[model samples]
Target: MEFTPVTHVLFDMDGLILNTENLYTVAFQNIVSKYGKDYTFELKLKLMGSQTHETANTIVKELDLPMTPEEFIIESKKQFELLFPDTEVLPGAKRLIEHLHNKNFPIGLATSSSEESYHLKIDKHHQALFSLFPYKTFGSSDPNVKRGKPYPDIFLVAANKFPENPKPEQCLVFEDAVNGVKAAKAAGMQVVMVPDQRLDKRMTTDATLVLNSLEDFKPEIFGLPPFDD
Candidate 1:
């Protein structure tokens, strides 16, 4: 299969860069269990890559919980604040990011997280790794991004932030969620997906390329600089 050459790369932060999916699962479970609801992987697949308020709304509606989305957000934020600081960089995430940065490739972050939650996840742990990104779009917080993933707004917003303002076809998105892959494709960009193993194989069909992990990626195939190590 031939891969199109790409000029800039945009990344999703949660499962792609940080091993925080489990932490989110823990947090979500903690909240939903109060209502005697089970937070299942199927629900997680549907919710991944959604903005903060969107996620709370989905969970409230999906589980028929006894709280408003606002109340759910308040509870979720309490859990996130306590849990997110323990976030760890995923395997191969730092290596690939540093490789792209050292090669002078323009890379940006586009996360569904609000700025407050984003900092809670990365500030104390992976700040330096994330600092390599010159541009970052916090979908839940950026008024310019009116919609989140599955809408393409965040990826489109991120690509526009590049100094040269590349066309959608010139940007490559790296994501770990089906919603993100759909968003990237809808934005007319190619996406490399490194999804969780539990994700249904059928859900991965929209990705331009799918990998087991970022460590398995070869930048040269996408016309980027090859890794020295």
Candidate 2:
């Protein structure tokens, strides 16, 4: 599909910019292991881009874990505390963000992470990197975001936060989850999906483009400034 030149960029946090997806996978594995259940890739994909409550319930129902959502949350919290503090930035993520920042592009973060969870996900090592984005919509807790990904609420809210309030068509979103791609499309924006290798390519066919990693993204194709060679 063809797309117009984009003036604004919105990025998803977990799997797109950071290696939190791996961390999350480990946490989920640690949780399910206690019950002798495997937190398979398919299950991880379903939980990807989901909100806190949504993830808990999905885990309980899908895994048949004998625990309430709240209990799941409590158990998961233990693992999160240990794993989330030292996440690595995805390859090329810093370069891309810095390129956009230097060009003075209107950029923002539209993530499913709640405010509290956001802190855990962005430790001091990552705080400086993320601060480059002037606006961020933490969907799990933002009042203006009535719905999370797979809906347009967070994307719309992030887009509107730009000083120029660019139209949805003028926004380009970078995501690593199917629900996030759907959310951007629902908001009338073009999306580039850099999904997990375990996720089938067919699952991301709806995206404007799909790549194995952020390192493979080509800025000029989307009308953004290309990186220094």
Best by lDDT: 1
> Candidate 1: where is the Cα deviation over 4 Å?
none
Model 1: weakest 10-residue lDDT segment is 122-131
The all-Cα superposition gives candidate 2 an RMSD in Å to the true structure of 1.4
Candidate 2 Cα misplacement greater than 4 A, ranges: none
Error of 2 at 20 (Å): 0.8
Summarize candidate 2's per-residue lDDT along 32-102 as a digit string, tens digits.
89899999888887777778888888899998998899999898888888888888899989989999999
- Whole-model lDDT values for every prediction: 0.93, 0.89
Model 1: how far residue 57 lies from native, Å:
0.9
lDDT of 2 at 121: 80
**Least lDDT summed over 10 consecutive residues: which range in candidate 2?**
42-51
Cα lDDT over the full model 1:
0.93
**Best candidate according to TM-score:** 1
Q: Write the per-residue lDDT of candidate 1 for residues 1-229, one digit (tens) a residue.
A: 8899999999999999998889999999999998789999999998999998889999999999989999999998999999999899888899999999999999999999899999999889788999999999999999998887899999999999999999999999999999999999999999999999988799899999999999999999989999997
lDDT of 2 at 195: 85
Error of 2 at 95 (Å): 0.2
